[model samples]
Target chain A: MSWVNWILVICMYPFVLIMYFCLKNEGHDPKKRVYYGVSLSKEQAEDQIVTEIGNAYKKQMKRLLWISFLTSVPVLILPSFSIAFTYWCFWFLFVCFVFFWPFGIANKKLREVKLEKGWTTGEAQPRYTEIKEAAGIRKVKWYHFLGPVVISIACVVWAVLQPRDGREAMLIILAATFGGMTLMFAALAFWMDKEKTAIVSSDSNVNVNYARARKNMWKNFWVAFAWFNTLYTVGILFYQVQESEVTGMFWLLLGLYILFTVILLVWVIQKSKALEERYADKMDLKVEEGDDAHWLWGMLYCNPKDKHTMVNKRVGLGTTINLATPVGKGVAVFLILTLLSMPVLGIWLILDDFTPIQLKVEENCLVAKHVTEKYRVPFEDVREAQLLTKLPNIGRNYGTSMDNVKKGNYRLRDESISCEVLLNPENGLFIRLETEDEIYLFSGFDDTETRQVYEAMIK
Target chain B: MVIILQDGSEVPVFKQIRNQIVMGISDGRLQPGEKLPTVRALAEEIGINSMTVNKAYQLLKQEGYIMTDRRNGVRVRESFRMTPELPLESKEQLKQLVSEARVRGVSQEEFMALVEEYFSAGQRE
Candidate 1:
């Protein structure tokens, strides 16, 4: 396995736990009016059957969490990074499916019991908003996005003006990273401002204050995100330019960044939940007319009657698209397609890693090939071909870097560029073939095969 | 200004909007010259069709309850034209109401008492 595999595996186990807790947090909220994604009255929520269902769902998720942990054990021993990476992808999806499956089941059961006991919250959509609150300027203004946008733009410009070498690809990625995150935050701010401020009670003051507080919290979050990304960009770029792994500094900064990000996310989520509790603490469903029926699986919001495309999520921190409108349907289709493509991408990566690298001598020329990557250098242009047991700090500029395969353009720390079509770096053998245009690093499937190919080329 | 919409109510969405706004005015919750949300904004806020809110606004404008213009958007009328007689619509409603009260065994004295209490429901100065 490679460093990428190790990083992903480390990140994933904690993620499973995080997802579990997020679902657990969704249990009972006056703002949401649901238990396990099922709407119920205060009396029904306390019913023996309802309590039993909630516990059962929890137990099932715990079992799935343990199972997910166990399955990852096999991934550690997987032969290559490709296998491990593929297993991790599918395993993550499996954990997600199994985790949500119990919630969906519990939701279904609770809904059934609600119907049988006549304890429905009520059949209400986004059907109410006070007049004054509707017109209240309780939104984060557009200028709230200005700070982040300006910082990210400066970062992108800085990246662009950096000296152009063969590292153009690397710089472009840096620019894209900063620019993309800025755009995302800006869009999020805009989308959120456009959403209707929910009327939690008859009091417009409470509603207005609640809306303003939430908007301010998110505004702070986006601003913090900008600072975080800026620091990361500066740190990474400094290291790249120096052509040295300030490994200790890089790791420390990365660790702190991740820590801060997690804390910020958790803070926002808790603050939002608290804000709901503070404002609508006395909110109680008086009739069977609840919003549970409008949500699918207690997660997705779908109300055909709601003209707005974006609606507040029933469970999580962010908003979800309504599945009733044309835009909502389009978003749903896109998400479904994306979910379906995960496994396909995993399979494709595995195939790419397993594809053998071939070095052939033909017609006074040498060709090193792996998958779709082919590098041919005429004997006349080939200045040198040297076999080595180790490579330099060959960082990828724009290429594939799987455990078994490394192909396409790469660069030495602080150096220009090289084209590599190498397989099985674990074999501890490689060939440095230099041509007029660029350097080529290559190898065969094994030491013996590579040595044979090198001898033939020399002859 | 809180209005709980009954989607299953027989009242059309536009009528519900109009009724609520009119009630708000009479209840003094809506002040004269107070700006109202645009047709699109109110419709989106209430999660209904924009045209529904437009129709309500058009009705309100025609009845001189509200006004609309390019610069002002929509707002409650500063003052309404005072007439000595009740509108035909109110007359019809009053006719139905009195007939119901008579059938329900309400004496003239009791009916007039109720009328006095409601007529003086001027909670706002």
Candidate 2:
């Protein structure tokens, strides 16, 4: 019902739609001559069983698409963000597992059909690369890095110039962060330009042209991302300089940035597919290099024999690591753990937001509590305590900021920093307690309760 | 121009690279003074070790089949003479091949004719 809830729904819809469409078109794409990431000859791919299996997979994907999209509708009317946040986190893990379930099923079925029909592409086929295609002629020029490098340096300069208020420092660091991000894109673009492209066609010219087209597309994507970083960095700097309200502006910038990134990614994927199809279309659908044994369920690539750490993914748009390598295994474990911990993250968010802030006098100490994070100051140590009608213009720096609960380390607009805070801002009352070494702000569930705590603390 | 490498081949990767370039030259697909990819570039392209490619390039350079400089990277030789006398290694290998062909009922004249057919392309170029 709230604006924030609406934002959540809007954000989720596009993601699911894109995932659905991409997976829908994936595996059995005639252009790539791949059926469920399995390399099959034209005759084998066109078999009756293949069609029946592919259609069955399509039907299941359509059902999943509806389920994914329809589930998002319920979040629009969710009373609180905690429940919605929890749902979204779980939903992410669900989609990650469920969407791929269909792929895995389809891959297994197609691979079975491939074997049963005596259509096995050889396990150890040679990797063919044309010399002219490998020639590093169309390299990323040195000048292409100039703008992003300059921006990164400028960010550091801006950070150095800014006043060292905690929030102001964060804003300055953000400029540099954007600089780092932009530079990363520049580097990635450069590296990708140099990386070898997949050989799709027997014709060297066609293969060479396809590689060039794909490289150009990736280069454009990185360039776009670099510019995006600069633009968003400017917006953040503007907010910091103007000392403007963040609620609406933060959401607007963040939403637009996410939406822009998604659109760019989708365009890159679709364009790359088109280019491959255009060139590879001319080639006879002869089985090229096939490593069906290394690809687990046609999704996970686990080839130790591969010298390269990263390999072109058989099923998807991007590259995946060779999981048999040490670094690859570490990354895999980290990713799996991160996905598995989403429910725990949702729980943590709930506890941070829903737990009531307790402000009470115990043994002459002004004790503030929220879950395990607590701050206690002796009344004798409190140098000054002021009861303010309104909270300061502040933003979260390191802790939780919920709609009702604000329990965090925060920074004010005046370049000042609050060390500890546990307040419910809707009560419209706060106790700004200052000590020799620390600044603490506390408020209770209601204004009356906060007033009592303030009266007791000042006594 | 398409350099294909079998993953499970008994030949070392560097040998595979070296042999392919030699065959390409023999077939005239790769011409005299034609630019080859840099060691790093070729290694990355083929998903092999740079050291492996370097060894191949080193062998090619030692045999006067290719040349390398900082500016030009690596390239086929501007012109290299095809000597009539084969190296001891090649002669040994040729003897083995001839014996195999003789055992397989491919007469010496038939094998010589096959050899002539392969050499004729480069000779014409």
The candidate scoring highest on lDDT is 2
Chain A only: list TM-scores of all candidates.
0.84, 0.88
Query: What digit string (tens of lDDT, one per residue) describes model 2 on residues A1-459?
Result: 767667656766777877877777765666557777787767777888888888888899989988887777766776777787678778777776677778889889887777776687556877776677474635566687787678667866877786755555566567777778788788767766765666666566666776677677777788878877877777677675664556756657767787888788788888867765666557543435367777887778887766555666664576677799787798789889989898888788888777888888999998888888788889889888899898888766556677788877776657555467788877789998889977877888789889998887666
What C-alpha lDDT, on a 0 to 100 scale, does residue A167 get in candidate 2?
55
Q: Fraction of the real A/B interface contacts present in each candidate? A: 0.52, 0.70
The residue-by-residue lDDT of candidate 2 on B56-121, one tens digit each, is 999999988999999987889988865868889989999999999999999879998999887786
Ten residues in sequence with the least summed lDDT for candidate 2 chain B: B116-125
Q: Compute each candidate's TM-score over C-alphas.
A: 0.84, 0.86
DockQ of 1: 0.46
Worst 10 residues of 1 chain A by lDDT: A281-290
Candidate 2: give the clashing pairs. none
Task: Residues A19-78, candidate 1: write the lDDT tens digits.
Answer: 777776665453545677775656667789987998898888888888888888767778
